[model samples]
Target: MERSHDGYDLFSPEFRADPNAHWAAMRQAGCPVAHSDKWGGSFMPVAYDDIRDIARDGARFSSRAIEVAGPLEAAGGLYLPPLTSDPPEHKPHRGVLMPYFLPARIAEFEPFVREKARKLAEELAERGGGDVVTDFAQHLTIAVLTKMLGVPPGEQFTDWMIRMIRVGPKDQAVRAEAIHEILGYLGGLLDEREVEPRDDLISYLAAADIEGEPLSRKHKIGAAFLVLIAGADTTWSAISASLWHLALHEEDRKRLVADPSLLDTTSEEFLRVYAPVSVARLATQDVELHGRSVAAGERVLLAFGAANRDPEVFEEPDKIMIDRKRNRHLTFGSGEHRCLGSNLARLELRITLEEWLRVMPDFRLVDPDGVTWSGGQTRGPERVDFEVVR
Candidate 1:
C-alpha cells in the first residue's frame, strides 16, 4: 500500500529523505496539484500562489480537520482550538490566545528561551558532539513548552508529545493512547488551576472563556494540547533542520559565524529553505484548481514548504542565502490560520542559533549520509548527529 503521488511515493523513505527535490520535480513537470490516494485521497498544492489562495480561502478550505488522513474528527476529535477551529469559533479561540503570543508578550519569554538554548548548546559543546534533534533541539523545545504550561519539567511529557505529534498521526493505537494520556494530564492541571490559578497558559485557559461562557474542560485541555503538539515538534524540526543545514554547508555556516549580525536573515533563510509543517485543509465544495477538480471534502495538503521554494516566488529558491533580501516566505503559512506562535518561534530560533554558534561554531555532521527525517503533515530531520571540531 504505497502512498503514491504522481509517480512519487509520499510515504516512502526516499520522499521523506528529500521531499524538496521531489516537490521541485513535480513543480517543474507543470504539476501544480499532485494527487495521492493515500489517506483516503488528498491533493498537494505546490505553487506559492495556489497554496496561498487555498490557505486564505477558509470558506472553501475548512481547518476543522487538518490531517492528510482526512478530517480531525475522524481521529477521535481532540478539539485543539484555534488550529483546529474554523471561522467564528476560530476568531474567538484565536482572540483569547492572541495576547499570549503577541510580540510584546512573546518577548517576555526571551530570557527563558535564551537560558534554555545556552544550557543545551553548552551541554552539546561539552560532549564535543551529539544528535542535534534529541540532545539539543527537542530538549530545548520541550523545556520551553513545560515552562509555558507551568508544568514540572519531565521526560514523560516529551515522550508523550513526540509520540502524539510525530508517531501518533500514523498509528491509531498510539494516537488514541497518547491523546488519552495528554487529555488526562492536562485535565488534572486545569482542575488545579480552577481552584488555585497560576501565571501560566493552563491557568489562563482554565479561567478563560469564549464569548461570555467559561470554556469547557475539553476546550481547555485541547488548547493546552495544541500548545504541546504545535509548540514541540514544529520548532524542534525547524531548529534541527537549521543545524543540519549548517552542519553540511561549511561555507554558509562559516559566513554566519564570521558575521553575527547576519543571524536575523540567516534564521529566516533557514526557515524558508527548511520550512517544516505542511498543513491539510478539507475542501468545502467542488473546485477546479489548475484545471484539476477537487470535490468537496477532499483533503488538500497545503505544501507551504514547497510554496516557499517556488522559483516563481523565490529567486534561486533552493539556495540558502543568509542575506536573501525581501524574503517573504510563507513558512508561517498565510491567512487567518497562520501560525499563532510565529513570533515566539522566531525568538526561540534566533536565540537557539545565537547561543549554539557562540558555543559550538565549529560543529559539523557526524555523517552526512546518516541524518534521518520524518515526513507527513510535518517533515524534519529525526536525528542530526553533529561533532564539534576542537
Candidate 2:
C-alpha cells in the first residue's frame, strides 16, 4: 500500500515474508517497472514480456555482476563461468559443462538420486515427524551435489556453502570470509584431482578444454564454485516449497497421491507458483521501458516468481490449477542464462515428491504460522515441520 521512496525495498522483512502480495500491489497500481534505491539502486520488472525481453537482450543487459545486495566475486576475481560470463565467452564456457547435464548423463544419476531420496523419506516416516527443510531437502541435495563435484560427502561441508549463499548476500564481511574459505577448500580438491585424476566433475574439469585452450586453474575453480553455489540452494528451495504446498492442501495432496502420473504437471505448477530464484543484470546502456528510465550500470532485478504469476500470461494467475492444460512459466528462466541444471533439477524434484508421497502419504504442517521463510534472491521455507496424518 505505502511505499518507501515510491519503490519497494526488497530487503525489508515484510517484502521477504510475502513478496507476492507486494507484487500484486505494484501491478494494481499499474507500475510495470518499479524502482528501488536499495542495494545501489535496482529496477524490478514484474510482467512476463518485460522480463523475457530483458533476458534475451544480452548485449544491453550484462550478466557479469549478478549480485543485488552485495558483490562477491567468484574465486576472488575470476567470473563464475557461464553463470556470470557474457557473449562469446559465455557460449564456449557453457558448452564445456553441457555434457555433464545432458539427459543421458542425468539419467545415469537417477538411480543415485532416487536411492538417496527414498532413504530420507523412510527416515522421516520412522521419526513420525521432522523439519523437512533441514532433515530432508537439504540433506538429499547436499549429498547429490557433493558426490557429483567429487568433494567430501557430509553435511559439515555444507555449513559454509549455505552461509555463503544465504547470509552473504545481505552482509559484506561475512561473504568475503566465506568466499575465501570456500576457495581454499575447493583449491585443495582441485590440486588432488590434478595429481590423481578420478571419474568425477573435478577430474573432468582438470583435463577439460575450453575451445582449443586448456582451462586455467582459476577457471576450473570458478566453474566448481558455480556448481557449489547455484546447484544446491535453487533445487532444495524448489523441493522444500513443493512439500510445503502439499502439506497445506489436502485435496491437491490426495489427488496427486491417487494418480502419481499427475506429478509431471504438478511439478511444473509448483515451480511456477513458488519460483525460487531472482537473478540480477547490469544495464549496459540507458533504456526506457514502461515510462521509466534505467541508466547504464544500474541493476535490473528479474523477479521470475512475479513474472510467472502475471495475469496476462496465465488464465488464473493466483490459483494453482494442478491440471492446467496450457502452462508456460519462466521458473527455470529464459534465454542464454536459463538454468543449466534444469534437467537435473527436474529429476530431483520429481523423485523427491514421488518418494515422499509413497512413504509419507498423509501429512500436515505441525504449525503453519511457525513456518518461517528465508529471504533475498532465492526464497523458501526455512523450516517445514510436519507429522503424519494418522
Candidate 3:
C-alpha cells in the first residue's frame, strides 16, 4: 500500500517467494481492488469471494486478455478457443473441446500415465540423484501431452514451450517470437495430420465437427495450442512442487509411502497447497467488489492461489496437511472457466508420487537452501536435487 507503483507486482521476487504473506498483507490493507500498471493497468482481487466473483460473471468480465494479446493479436492471430472466447460463443468452442477432457476420457489415459511415471521414476531411482523438475517432471508432462495429441516428440516443441511459458510472462519480445515459432510448428503438424491421421487428439481435431462441418483451421490450431500450453507447464509445476514438499516433509512422505491409497486425498491436498495457476481477465463493465470500484475494461489478475490460502477458507492455510479433510480450495478457477486439465493433472500427480515412493522409498534434499523455484505465471521447483536411498 505504501509502494509508489499503482498496484502490487505479481512478478516480484519477494511476492513469488511468499505470496501468502503478501496476500495476507493485502487483505489486511483492506483494499481488495489492488491496482498495478504492469499489464496495462490491472486490478488484483485478493479475497476468495472477490476472485471467484470476477471469474463467475462472464457478463461482467471478458477473457480476451487471459493470455498475451499485445503481439499475439493480429490478423489471423492465435485465438485461444474456448478460454479466450466469452459466454454464448464460449459455449460451442468449449463444447467441441470438452469431450476429450471428460473424466471418463481421461480415465483411458491412466495406464499410460502410470507407465510413463513408472519408467521415469525407475530411471531417476537408478541414478539416485536428480533434479525433480528437469529429470522427472519435464519428461512425464511432455510425453503425456505429446501422446494425448498423437504427435511425435521434438526438442523444439518442449524447449520452446518452457521458454514461451516462463519467458512470455516476463519478456514480450521473446514471448512474441516464441508464439510465432509455436504457431508455425503447429501449422506444419496440422499438415502432417492431414495425410497420416492417427488415433490421437491431433487427428481428432483435424476431423472434429461443429455446426455440421469440419472445424476451421483457426479452431484446430487454437484447440491444439490450448492443450499444449495449458497441459505442459501446469501439470509439471504441480507434480514438481508436490515432490519438493515430500522431500522436505518426511512424516507426510512416510504416511503416503506406507499407504498408497491415501494418494487420493493426498493429491487433492497437494493441489490445495501447491496449486499453480493465475488467470487474467478484462472487466466488461464497472463493478463494485469488496467495497472497491473496478472500472470497465480494467485488467484483473485472479490470484486463485491467494484465494486458496485465505485464512477464512482453510485453517493454517500456509501449512500443508497431507491428510487435510474438506479443503475447498480454488486451485482451479471457479465457474465454467475452471481448468479442463484438472483430471489429467490429478492423475499425473498421484501416479508420479506413487511411482516415486514405490521406487525411492527414502529421499531428502541434497541442499535445502539450494532448491530453486520458478515464479510469475506458474510456480514450482525449477530444480530440486534429491539424495535417494533406493
Residue 190, candidate 3: how far off, in angstroms?
1.4
Please, what is the whole-model Cα lDDT of each candidate in the order they appear? 0.84, 0.85, 0.80
TM-scores for the candidates: 0.96, 0.96, 0.94
Stretches of candidate 2 exceeding 4 Å from the true structure: 1-5, 71-78
**lDDT per residue as tens, model 3, 1-390:** 333224566667776676777777776766566666664456677778878877888899887668422232331234888878888888888888888999999999999889989998888888887888888898899988998988766667667877777776677778779889888888888889888988888888888888988888988988899999988888889998898889999999999988887898899988987878887777789877655577887667787888888887789888888788888888888898888888889889988999889888899898988766666668777788888965
Per-residue error for 6 in candidate 1, Å, reads: 2.2
lDDT of 3 at 155: 64
Which candidate has the highest lDDT of all?
2
Better of 1 and 3 by TM-score: 1
Question: When superposed on Cα atoms, how far off is each prediction in RMSD?
Answer: 2.4, 2.1, 2.3
- Deviation in angstroms for 367 in model 3? 1.8
Give candidate 2's TM-score.
Answer: 0.96
lDDT of 1 by residue, 140-206 (tens): 8888888899988888877886677677667768878888988888889988999999999988998
Provide the lDDT at 221 for model 2: 91
